[model samples]
Target: MEARLETEVCVIGGGPAGAALALRLARLGHAVCVVERHAFPRSHVGESLTPGVWPLLDALGVVDEVRRGGFLPALESLVCWEEPTGRRVRGRAGEPGLLVDRGRFDALLLGAAASAGVRVLQPAVAQRPERTADGWELPVLHEGRRLVVSARFLADASGRTACLGGRKQMVSARTLALYGYWRGDTPHGPETRVEAGPDGWYWGAHLPDGTFNAMAFVDPELLRERGIGRRTLESFYRELLGRSSLLEAWTAPRLVGSVLACDATCYRDTVPIERDRIKVGEASFSIDPLSSSGVQKALQTALSGAVAVHTLLARPEHAEAALRFYTEDQRSSAEQHAAWAAGYYRDARSYQERPFWKRRALAPAAVAPLEVRPPLSEDGLSHRRWRLASDAALVDTPCIVGDVIELRRAVSHPRLGRPVAYLEGVELAPLVDWLGQVPGEGLTMPQLADSWARRMPFRRSVAIMGWLYRQGLLTEVTADGPR
Candidate 1:
């Protein structure tokens, strides 16, 4: 007999993105169902979580659990990018990133989602979805039974497969990653290692499970030109590692698994969101592996996507605002990461002239040059009176207000990325209006800060003013008269 289920939101792929979205939506009192092709505890890549992920995990109420999950704390990174000599980069005194066993980490998240009241269908395969007048209907095969899942809203978190079809616009040069796990007689240090080579780059890290993963990224054409096939994949991967200074540090390193290859190219979906459907994580965009923030970015998208989906379902009037917010957020993130990766690639002095490096060294044309302001000393800040810059203005922008997306008046300036809707949890529109109401001569730094202090903490107010100054949104009034 066929089984039938209905929900308000149905998410495909129960990885971090899908699970997090289901968890958040369930917490928001929405009926959510998740269809995961693999069961929990499946092996996955992208195990390194940057420090920025801590805040998101805290927001999801999973920080304590993750802390107790027995993952290794990533304290330092050993890099050999610019030269042959390696440099160690340490984390903050008390804050460190994580090196996790992806299988267990992902299963933990999926478990959290189920505990939050989200109906989960594991070990299930979802066929191509059929769009319904209201939302989507998916045919799923599970446990020798055919099941049909109908949902009012659909989310695609299936990673590169992108279960929901859309044309992806390439954001960087095409790349492929070949990797394998290894066992060694001696323990490698806990620090993550990255090295740049003549033709490609290498990354290696010791996981909590006593295994080390070494990966090499190169242009796919190089593999084709070398005539590397399934029988020769292992030898090629081993030969590539032999050329690395960092990854080859283990004593008596022996391969434990077959070599695996995957596309690591960067791209973004042209349409990430719509009225009834959304794409999160790799389904929406894939950034360069150079950042090693793929998991962090996926979680970020899920958190924001939850809000966007909620707004679409509960507040239909703000549909346009919700769509615009998610689309812009995805685009901005993809572009910014692509630019950063290109800049980093350009910094590789070892093989920068090689086709693999040179092709990826140039930033995309869509990326705008970052505007940096000159530093101001305390005396400089105190002596000058300030006013909002003439180019700064209030514009209607979609912002995340509490749980839903709403149109708010935000401060817009050429130096700012997008618009400023809030700073440190305080609304900015009213503050901008107050600044605009100041006299033509403007107010001194102390006066302006004191005025804002009445609305928020004094320190926060001062910090906000400092941000404005750095953004070039505040102009100084001088004896030369507001130059």
Candidate 2:
């Protein structure tokens, strides 16, 4: 006999986003069901988490469990900018984040969802979501048979598969990604490492078990122009990272995990969120990874999605408005970040000198006035500087050596060049106070670093202020106010 199930809410693709949503709805006493194609302990990329994600997991009551999953603390980040002078600048090191095992992480969260009474179907391929008379019908291929499950609301948290968005003709290809995992000599200090060059950008970080999760992102147009094929992804990445020099230290042949591949793109919907349907995570909105906002975005979608689903089940009329607001925020966030990521990629040495960049870089969409908001704390000076440069300054011109050096100094602040040996255990408060003497507004990170260096330049300043923000010392306020 073919299996049949009934649920108030159906979540497709039980990744972090889907699982989180499922757990929320199930905990709220809803008959929620989640469909996933993969079992636990599967190989997934994106092994790092930005700092604030813990709060979301905590809110979902899964924080303690996730913490037990061998999470590694990320201490700081190192970003390399290739400049026009044929030199490179390693700019802006800030506070730590987290390096996690995606396999363990996904399994833990999905398990939490299941524990919360969410009926989970694994190794099941979801074919499509068709609207039924009363609600929605989710068709899936399970055990060589088609199973149709009825749900009051259908959620597509299917990552880049874009289940609902793809079928409905709402997703747009605004950006693309090539991601994989690696396990060579792990990078020290648990930092997210970023290298920028003409061809594209590369990001990698140490995973929990001393492996590495790394990937490259490039413009689809550029990839097409150069005729990039799967077989050549390694050579392409190697050549690109070789220019930055930072990747050289870890590119040895002995890494444990072989390189894998995945694609990411920014997709926005043509129709607003309506009753009976919602898309979350990569399916709802996606941008490039330059901002490292993947997991955070997914969490945000789940949180808001839970509320929307509840409202839909309870009130029904407010469903459209709730979903509309959800999608509007998603679209606004993606567009803002995508414009910045695309512009930052254009500033790379490989693209800046090429005609392709000349056209795209100068296009109206590449550069738009952004509503600027100052960082929440003085500590986020370095991060804010990078944001402004990538979002505002680089949109106008290519990044130069001087620009990058300036960013470094800003990140370092008063601590510029002073070795630990010289400080001899002095409290860091005095040093931070001294650095705060220099105003940060209207200056890039490099300029601030230069200013602090002039005071007494011997130590590397990984601007503690930016680190402060990562440590939650600051709050981000939008134009309207704190969000």
Candidate 3:
């Protein structure tokens, strides 16, 4: 006899996205059941989270638990990319992103979901979802027993598993990442560090427990060429890191029980949100890792999905509209991120030295015109200004501004408090020169602001170009193009 379990919502894949959605649904007084192929405390990759994560956890009322589960605060990211200056221009992680151990973090989220009255079945995998007239029938396998789960709605949060592939099978470019953790004697700072290393790129952060989290992404072609075995992948990773003085110092010999590896980087082909089912997190849209929007994107997907799911479950008549909105949002996020990745890796200045980087780095940020502004002079005595194409009034012969405006854009914050912002580029320079040459260098951001507090006019015909980088603009960048 087939066992039967009934639920209002069935969530597959107990990763961050799955747990989040399940928790939200249960909190709404729905009988939600989450099925996971793996148990809690299992290892996973993409160990970073943008500030946006805070709001999601807060909404679920699990921020304190997540914070205690070895989550490290990330101030900024030090990224080395190719530029005309022949030097790496470091970029911030958009105001204090968090570094987390996926094992503990995922477990914490799943536990919280369970506590919220969501039923969780560990080591339970969904083989397929059979469409039903009233809802959907999911054939789930837990341990050695097979069971049928009936739910009004189904969510595919199974990471790369794509359990509901019958509706849409996402096509992905094959990619590989080899990484591990270590306890070393070296000293480090609070910032999570990343740079183009021998293998591909390395990201490391200091955990609260005095240990270090580090990993290297190896080239797929090189890994194949070397014919590295499962055990040898870890050894090869160690050897590759040994060449980097900065990373090598912190990593002594260590053991990685189950080395984390993934074959999909870009989540180009995935199911769109629809009436009968929805895909969240990596299952919905996975993009290149260079963008570092992994956890942020996942949380955003789940949160936005919660709204749609709630609307549909509460008002079944408007289910189509909710699905449409969710699909559009996912498309915008994926395309914008892909464009950025293209610009970053495609530019030679970022990683021309390493053949592996040449292949991986070429992808640009999926979004065009990514709030990029010209850098400030090191001396602070002089500031440079440029015209942005997006500005309408200044489309032609735009006047130069002395300082950058709104450089400190707080990405996320609670409704009651002020959000944190980080400095991006310099603004308003022409006005400063016209009024009186402000003393350069040794000047702080505040002092620069006080000196040229008022906006002025410029006769020098500085034009802000009227270019719109909606998304996927990075696809235009090539080796032969103008740097």
Candidate 4:
């Protein structure tokens, strides 16, 4: 039988992003439908889940059910990505998390959405999304019948496929993961073990069902140059496993299926929302697996995207402003993740000389670091003065920016009660102020230190201006009030 209907929101791709979004929207009193091409219990990757996901699940009212699913508890991680092995706890005390079976984990979330009154269609392919009188219309094939699903708003959670193609997909890191199931004598405890190899990196984990999962991260260009992919992945994976110092202890290792590949490249494929449609999850942005934040980050988008859409629909006058907030949030998140990952590579000093690490570690903060910190020298800031300037790309959210209040800043995630301002995700506010006492050209490091010496140390004030100069948030107006 054919079907035709309209919903307030049509979420494509039944992964965590789409499912969580559907559930949130449905509860908000919106007609929401979720379409999935693959049925449940399918082969899936990205099995390691984050503890931060627990609160998200609780907010969705699925925490107990997921915990009852018999997934293993995870709390610690071991890393050998560089020299000596390092161990770190995921969180302090009661913050234990779970290690999940990807296929089962996703299925659990999807089932929760279905029970929440969300219209769900499985094994359905969505194609040809276009603008309609109400909003966006999409064609779908379900149960051997062609149907049209129209909605006033669209949510594309289709992962990297980006159901809406032709949009720009920019690669921040060129990397891929080749992995397969391996079962044998366990080499280590249940915690995840990550190692950095000469070519790329290695990740191994112990599954709950008495098996193991192994993955290798490497650039495709390296594979082709060395004729690696020419051979079957079985041989290639076996080669990687044999060479690893940690996994080499496993007895009689075996491959469970053909090796699968997933893009590990740090990328921002497209904007989060445009017009009547919003893209969440992997469709909007995909992070590198190094942080193990794939699931946590995706669900965050779902949570925020749902609220953004609700605001857009209920308050028509705030559509542009709502979408703008969502876009900036997503962009800042992706860029920050990329920068931190590079910083980690840099911290792995032993491997900094390796090409695999060199490309990532050497990049400047302005180019990749989370917050650009420029070195301070007398000559560098001695002649420089800075005055605060407004940023067009930012939406000034009112909050305490310094000891004073009522600072209008578009980007901020302040640390403590301390005031900080950011332009285009580059933090600027805490360093410069409207202190008109400095010379018109601006306060040189010596002048700035003298003016605010009571507030902070001399060298500290000097350092802050160096960063401000790199961010272009300061003005060099002459005493005449114009530069």
Candidate 5:
């Protein structure tokens, strides 16, 4: 007999993204069921987490658990990209990142989700889903037993598998990552290491379990061109590592596991979110591995995705805002990361002539050249008169308001990347509107700031004013006219 389960939200996959989403939804009083193919404590890649992940974890109420999980703190990094010689880069004190054993890290999150009243079906394979009048119905196989799950909303956090199945829009050159774990005497400090090679780049890091992971990212075409097959894959991976100065620190390293290869190219799902379904983490988009923030980005998507899903379920009137907010957020994040990766690739002087570097170093065409402006000294700020730029205006934008997505009036300018809804938790539309109401003759920086200070903090008003000037949203008033 087949078992049946019903939930407000059905999340596929039990990795960080799925688990985080399930946990958050359950905490929000929504019935969430998660179907995962793998059991707990399964081996996975992308172990490094950036410092930015702390706030998200804290928000998820998993900070204490993560701290006690025995993960290594990534206090420093050794890099040899721009120059041949490696240099040590240290993060801020008491706020280092983490080098995690992904297996345990993922399990910890899944366990948290289960403890939070989320129904978890581990070792379950979710089959194709069927759209229903209300939501979706999916068939799942669990431990030789067939089960059916019906949900009001569907969430795909299945990483690159993308169980929801949509066409992916490639954002970067096709690339492959070949990697393996090794056990050996510590030849280098606990810092993560990165080096740019002639044809590709190398990354190596020490995990908390005393195992070192070394990886090589290169063009997939290179493998076919060199006729690298399963029989010669290990040898070829070693040969590539031998050319690396940074990873060479592993003395007498013994391969603890077989060399594995997977696609690492950046891409985004053409449709990441809809009214009844949503995709988070790598299912929505994947960024370059150069930033070492894949796990961080996944968790970010989960947090935001949870809110989006909640709004879609509980506040039907805000469905459009919720969908638009999540879609725009995903696109913006992917594009920004792509641009950042290209800039970093261009900085690698060692491999500028190589095909891998040359292909990735080119910046995206959508990035506009930033307008350079002279710094405004305090004396100059008080002396010059200013008025709102002609192009600056208030536009309606979808923004996250507390728990639900809402349309808010935001300041818009060509110089700004997107509409600015808020800054440092202060609503910007009101401030921009007040600035517009100023006399055409304009006011000195101090005069305008003093008048605005009556409404808010003096420092906050000045900060917003400075941002306007920096973004060219405010223009100078000259003897002739506005400049």
Candidate 6:
């Protein structure tokens, strides 16, 4: 005697990731349902965001609404990480980002999703997720009732708890965040203030509501005995606040509330995708908040994840490939972000000896020269499997080298930050037209490189061939030796 609901997709956790996905998929004419454990306008942190988020929100048709929400603009950061005595201020006033009231921002998005034909259930807790042949059956608790939602796909947009991880915890740095809100002048006006101290680091930003939000990032062990309680947390927050000149400017500013704590560590989910279920947003992985990319990362993951899910449900034949791409890309993006944040810890010479900093400053993985295996030679025939990925519709971007309109398209990939080209900067796809119509046999990587060697040396062609192979653009085809 249980109530039941059915849909094409049931997304768990109605945060930005879940809501955004539900909105997009529903707009695509799919029956999507989003289940959330918390009610709207719930307390959540992470106000500071990256500028890159504007375009993503625009794509979702929410940018105009978000802009009119009167969120505080964040243009630059005032950093004090130089340790002994160093200060750096960087901001882009014209290209400023916003500091949001997280509760409100999240509520707006969820509401937008609901209005966009996405069925969102509030105060709903998801029980164990069971995978089915067609998709998944998610048992959800709402309004003192157990409801079963049957869907063709299940998405876990749960936050760092990553409900989808389902007891198989991924290895992650267990850094704890202790933060509080205050009514006073923040260290830097409107701009954020970041500094490194004994235990870990501190972040402070002026909220749009004429209040300030300050958070301390440190090892959980550092908070032993003197951490959670109201009095103890206030003392801990004060001790760390006193270390910063920014906080000292305030003379007994009124404390707004109790100090809240949560895990802010960087980690990735190693759980493989199963059945028709996938994880998006923090449910997939999380990184250090030091990068101030928490929200932006969630949006990016959601965007890509939507594409992946759509591909899987719409075109089952490509499910394997699409899902594979989604998982690998999400994991790699997390790894790269972790590596990027580690450098900040390592750069602070003042805390190199501190146990907290020392542990975080572990030597980053050394970058090796980009190389390809099974070598390339001119006499070999190069083969390809996947179509070339590019932003340009055709070889449209014109590049001039020695007086010729050598047009090329921008090759793009999730792992790469910018467009890439091979052999004298020509788009790899257009230059390989002859490979399909070779006279005798197929063209090897080197031959492809040589044909386009008009702007590159022979040795350089070899390198380009290897590069293309590494990018999975050119097939090795070295099995039968030059046939």
Candidate 4: deviation at residue 388, Å?
12
Candidate 4 vs candidate 5: which has greater TM-score?
5
Predictions in order: lDDT: 0.90, 0.62, 0.62, 0.72, 0.90, 0.72
- How many clashing pairs does model 4 include? 6
What range of 10 consecutive residues in model 5 has the weakest lDDT sum? 362-371
By TM-score, how accurate is candidate 5? Answer: 0.98
lDDT of 6: 0.72
Off by over 4 Å in 2: 82-96, 143-146, 165-176, 183-189, 221-223, 251-258, 339-483
How would you encode candidate 6's per-residue C-alpha lDDT over 218-280 as one tens digit per residue? 888787745446567778777877777556434566679887888887766775355477787
lDDT (10s digit) by residue, model 2, range 1-483: 767788889889998889998998887678998989987889877776776786798878987887677787776666665454323223235533567788898889899988888999887899878888888888887767878889988888888776875433322243455654554553444456777655556777766765666666666776677887877866766565456544443645243444455666555555425677778777777655666778878888787777767766765555444555565566656655656665665666545776434433432242234345455345755543322121111111111121010011112222121111112222334444443443434344555456556445424433543443343323333444333
| Tens digits of per-residue lDDT for model 4, 1-483 | 557877889999999899999988888788999999998877778877777887899878998888788888776667776575665546557757667887888999999998989999998999879887878888998988898998999889999888876365554558878888877655556677787877778887777766678888877777777677535666776776666654643676667767887777776755668768888888888877888889989888898887778777776565665666677668767877777787788777766787777776643342322344354553554565555544413335433222112325443222111124553333443334333334556555566556656666666655665555455445556566744
Candidate 4: list runs displaced more than 4 Å.
Answer: 84-91, 169-171, 246-249, 362-395, 398-483
Report the lDDT of model 3 for residue 366: 41
TM-scores for the candidates: 0.96, 0.67, 0.69, 0.77, 0.98, 0.77
Per-residue CA lDDT of candidate 3, range 227-259, in tens?
988868777777776754336435354553555
TM-score of 4: 0.77
Residue 286: error of model 4 in Å?
A: 0.9
Per-candidate Cα RMSD to the true structure, in Å, reads 1.8, 14.5, 11.9, 7.5, 1.3, 9.4
Question: What lDDT score is found at residue 131 in candidate 1?
Answer: 92
Q: How does candidate 6 fare on TM-score? A: 0.77
Model 5: colliding residue pairs: none
Q: Could you tell me how far off, in angstroms, the CA of residue 112 lies in candidate 1 after the best superposition?
A: 0.7
**Backbone Cα, N, C clashes tallied per candidate:** 0, 22, 41, 6, 0, 5
**Residue-pair clash count for candidate 1:** 0
What lDDT does candidate 3 reach at residue 329?
Answer: 71
lDDT of 5 at 259: 98
Give candidate 5's total backbone clashes: 0
